[model samples]
Target: MRAVTYDSYAKDNSRLEYREVPDPKVGPGQVLIQVRAASVNPVDWKVMAGGLDGMMDAVFPVVPGWDVAGVVSRTGPDTPEFAPGDEVMAYARKDVVQGGTFAEYVAVDAPAVAHKPAALDWAQAAGLPLAGLTALRSLERLGVGPADVLLVHGAAGGVGSLAVQLGRDRGARVIGTASERNHAFVRELGAEPVSYGDGLTDRVRALAPGGVSAVADFVGGQLETTLAVLTDGGRHVSVADPTVEQHGGHWIWVRPDGAKLAELAAVVDRGALTVEVAQTFPLERTGEAFDASRTGHTRGKLVLVP
Candidate 1:
């Protein structure tokens, strides 16, 4: 099998290279996937650069990535949930960081895999898992509910884009923060767009005089903005800032949960949510994909076609 690998956590991309490697083995309660498509996220590059070393122990010669949409090649014993040739997707983060989805094949624990949404093409499915899961997890953590008014900072970003639509599906009126260039795009996702600088609170106040019922911050440095727009005792969560806890807001770290992945897929299938894949690269160009993701400018997902 040919896969991208790095022997050590480097500060640069000089270590990434594509080469032949032994295929990942299916362990108990796991299944091997023949990867069709995977997507790049900021954490992929961050992890490769050793940014998450304290959070997750890594094995050398690491294959770095997590988002995947692929077909099952085989299953390990006791895995009755799926069989050969099942089309699936996952936020396949394991306890270890060596066998990621950026390869021709990856082994995933059954608990982290879900059937791909029927409405999505391979690219969209590949991009959906991590971003969608992050958005969903943050909203759930904030206890966002129907009839609530929600504010989404960085609402045009990878996770924010989905958060806007999911908030709408929950029957909340969503106010999304974006630049002028992305206002139309954010509006298309069912959010009322507000420019993200200076008068952010005033714009949100114009839309919701009583303040919003919940706030999800996908971009960091928005603790001030979130606190200002939120009603008294309103819910709030942040994926990018741990300091949110100091302000009585929850800090979320997404985990692999197949059941929640399936629920998100159903939302996509029902036409209540959609994924935006902005650009794609071939398997050998995984590093290039990461480069684009790190720019923090793409309005949608970056995919790796394996």
Candidate 2:
């Protein structure tokens, strides 16, 4: 199997290389997926640079990816949930960081795999698991609903884009913060777009009048904006800032849950949600993909086709 690997933490991402590696062995409760498409997230480059060393143990020559959309080529014993040829997707994060979704094939625990949504193409399906799951969890934690004014930071980015739609579907009047260039795109996602940066609080206040009922921070460094615009006793959560917990808000980290992923897929199938893909790269050009993701400027997901 040919896969991209980094021998060690390289802040410059100089160690990423594509080469032949041994095929993964399927263990009990695991299923082997022939990788069709893998999505690039900021964490992929961060992990390659040792950003998560304290949180996860990384084996040498680590493969870098987590979101995958593919077909089952093989299934391990006791994995009665799926068989070969099943089209599936997953946020396939394991306790260890060596075997990831960027390879030609990856073996995932059955509990973290879900049937792919028929409405999404390979790139879109690959983009959904992590971003969709994160958005879903954030909204669920905040208990967003009708009669609430929801504020979403980074509303045009990967996770934020999905959060905007999900919030609107829940009947919340969503106010999304994005750049001037992305305001139109954010508005298309069903949110009233507001430009972020200086005077962000005023922009949001102009829309909500009193303050927002909830704030979902998909991009970090928005604690001040969140605190300023949230109504009294309102809810807030941040995937980028753990300090939110100290300020009476939740710092959310998404987990691998197949059941939840399936539910998100159903939402897509019902035409209530959609995944946006900004670009697609071949397996060998992962370095370029990572660079693009690190820029934080892309409007949607960046996918890799293996």
Candidate 3:
């Protein structure tokens, strides 16, 4: 199998290289997937740079990626949820980062695999698992509902953009903060677009003078803005900020759940969800993709075609 991997942590993505590697083994209760596409996330590069080593352990020569949309090529013993020809998508992060989805093959636990949405192509499906799960998890933690007004920071980015659509699907009056250039893009995603930074709190207040009922901070460093705009006792959560717990808000990490991924796929098939890919790269050019991701300027996802 050809995979992009790094033998050690490096500040730059230069360590990421395309090489022929051993194929992943399918353990019992898991399935081996033939990778069609994989998407890049900040965490992928961060993990490659040893950012999470203090918390999540990583095995050296790690193949760094979690989001995959592929076809099941083989099944392990006792794996009954899927067969050899099933199309699947997964947030396949393991306790230790080793054989990841950035390769031609990955062995994933059956519980973390879901059928890809028929409405989405391999690249779009690849973009959904991690970003969709993060968005869904944030909305779930914030307890967003029909009557509430939900405010999302950094709403034009991957997770924030998904959160905007999901928030609206939940029946919340969704307001999304984005750069002026992305305002129209955010509006198209079913959120009322608001300019981010400077007077963000005041702008949201003008839109909903009574105050937003819930806030999901995808960009982090918005504690002050969130506190200012949220109604007292309203819900708030952040995936990027752990200090949120001290401010009466929840900090979230998306878990691997095939059931939740299926629900997200249902939304996609129902025409309520869609993905935008800013760029695509072949597996050999993964390092360039990482460089682009580090720019943090892309409005959509950067995907790898294996």
Q: Rate the local accuracy (lDDT) of all candidates.
A: 0.92, 0.94, 0.92
TM-score of each: 0.97, 0.99, 0.98
What would the C-alpha RMSD of candidate 2 be, to one decimal place? Answer: 0.7
- Report the C-alpha lDDT of model 1 over 146-209, residue by residue, as the tens digit: 8799999998889999999999998889999998999999999999999988988898999999
| Candidate 2 TM-score to native | 0.99
As a whole number from 0 to 100, the lDDT of residue 62 in candidate 1 is 94
Best by the lDDT measure = 2
Q: By TM-score, who's the top model here? A: 2
* lDDT string, candidate 2, 1-306, tens digits: 999998999987689999999999999999999999999999999998889999999999898899999999999999999999999999999998999999999999999999999999999999999999999999999999998899999999999999999999899999998899998899889999989888988888888889998999999999998998888999999999999999999999999999999999988999989999999999999999999998998898999999
For model 2, the stretches where C-alpha displacement exceeds 4 angstroms are none
Q: Runs in model 3 with CA error above 4 Å?
A: none
* Winner of 2 and 3 under TM-score: 2
Mind giving the per-residue lDDT tens digits that candidate 3 earns over 40-133? 9999998888889898887878898999999999999999999999999999999998889999999999999999999999999999999999
Residue 268's lDDT in candidate 3? 95
- Which whole-number lDDT from 0 to 100 does residue 132 have in model 2? 95
Clashes of 1: 0
